[model samples]
Target: MAFCPICNGFEEIKIACSSCGNALMDNGRIMDYYDDYSPYMPIDQMKMEDGYPADYENRECPHLLKCAVCGMNVVRLIKE
Candidate 1:
């Protein structure tokens, strides 16, 4: 549901790697990964009330975009 600023086209809310020009996968919020460490927590415990975090639109909790093709990665500060 995100658009590319450079191409003005709808993209998968992720950016391609600059070095490899390969599309990146949207791995979601950074906090979600940290929440996975709890031994007693449910697997789905990190679900958000909204589709995204409250501060996500304000460029907090950046999205982690990873490129499987070339191992290049980037952190994008997204705004809804």
Candidate 2:
């Protein structure tokens, strides 16, 4: 099975904020924000209903990136 390098702690992704040109922080998987128990659910199961049809099929993990300076939020799809 494919796995995310960032999620599995194999690497780090640094993103710059589009609005402020500042650093963006990795908040975690996008599904973790879906509900109270989302974080505890299986990763593959969450990806199936994560609103992105291609993520599960392509082995991609969607992460929530937030810019601390500009408060800008973005969804980054990381290849697994």
lDDT of 1 by residue, 35-56 (tens): 4463244323332432445543
- TM-scores vs. true structure, each candidate: 0.51, 0.95
lDDT accuracy of residue 69 in candidate 1? 91
RMSD of each: 8.1, 0.7
Top lDDT: which candidate number?
2
Question: Highest TM-score among the candidates is held by which one?
Answer: 2
Off by over 4 Å in 2: none
Question: lDDT per residue, candidate 2, 19-69, as tens digits?
Answer: 999999999899999999999999999999999999998999999999988
Model 1 stretches with alpha carbons more than 4 Å out: 1-11, 37-61
lDDT of 2: 0.93
Q: In angstroms, what RMSD does candidate 2 have relative to the true structure? A: 0.7
